[model samples]
Target: MITYSSNQPNLYLVGFMGTGKSVVGRRVAEALGMVFLDSDRVIEEKEGRAIRDIFAQDGEAYFRDLECKFAQMGHPKRGCVVSCGGGMVVPDYVRDLLKERGVVVVLHASVDVILERVSEEGHRPLLEGEDRRERIEALLQSRQGAYADAGEVVRTDGLTVNEVVRRVIGIYRLNEPNFPL
Candidate 1:
């Protein structure tokens, strides 16, 4: 088991779009009595613009840089759950940074499920102008390795929100006993 300091075990939920990271994260945080933070929301607040606007004005690379900074900023509260953006774990540095700080869990779902969940979410700039399903499929394929390399992979396709949150709490306890989730 990884021995973390008193402030360790910041649970970071990372995966492709529509993977329920934010929703599950909020629940897990509540269940464990920890704070919940969404990295994208943090970026949106700091940048003074919506994510779509950030992408439109600055491009993905710039947005990614901001994400990396946001991830590294280190939340004030220990044992918090952070819902990271889909592409956040694709960067090795970002993954390593999270690993150093705390546990990172990848929430996985089938491509069809991802497509279905993200269908109505028009704010995703990457899925904006193209064949949305194909784009999401391609993205999932591309990020599969990085997602797999995260702390643990939780397949959430058929699970209810409560089930997923319970799974996360269990995983947290099993994988990170030091933090006492």
Candidate 2:
């Protein structure tokens, strides 16, 4: 069993859409006995609108600005689990800020897997185009370096939600000094 210190820094989960950040993050937070926060959800709540609406009404740049603000001052507690949106870590400043605050784990999956998982969701602003697969591929390729630089990388392909949560907890445990193996 792994026990977290009261001083344990928050765990920030960063990944593309459909990589299970929100789903896995909830379980990880429950396991760690901490609060769970999703950045996109926070933004939506603050703006009184959905993310897709924000993007459509205010443009991606405006949405990115909101993301940066959230990265800076949205989180209200420590020893929590934060799940960031796909494009949140793309900005160097945001990535640096997240890294400074806590462990940034990048959850990843193949483009095909991402497409399959996100195909049913119509709320993705970036996938509003005709060829969603192509958009996903292009976005993944463009953001690959940023994701790699975010933190420890975990592949979610062919893995169940519990398996992913276990892996994240294992990785997190390795960073703690008082964890009992």
Q: What is the TM-score of each candidate against the true structure?
A: 0.91, 0.93
Summarize candidate 2's per-residue lDDT along 1-181 as a digit string, tens digits.
3555546787899999999999999999888887889999899899999998898888999999999999999885357789999999999999999887777889999999999889866678898866989899899999999999999999999999999999998887776443222
What is the C-alpha local distance difference test score of each model? 0.83, 0.87
- Mind giving the per-residue lDDT tens digits that candidate 1 earns over 90-138? 9898898887666788899987898888875667898988998889888
Give the Å shift of residue 56 in candidate 1: 0.5
Return the TM-score for candidate 2, rounded to 2 decimals. 0.93
What is the C-alpha local distance difference test score of candidate 1?
Answer: 0.83
Candidate 2 RMSD computed on C-alpha atoms after optimal superposition onto the true structure: 2.8
For residue 61, model 1's alpha carbon misses the true position, in angstroms, by 0.5
What are the candidates' C-alpha RMSDs?
3.6, 2.8
Q: Which pairs clash in model 2?
A: none
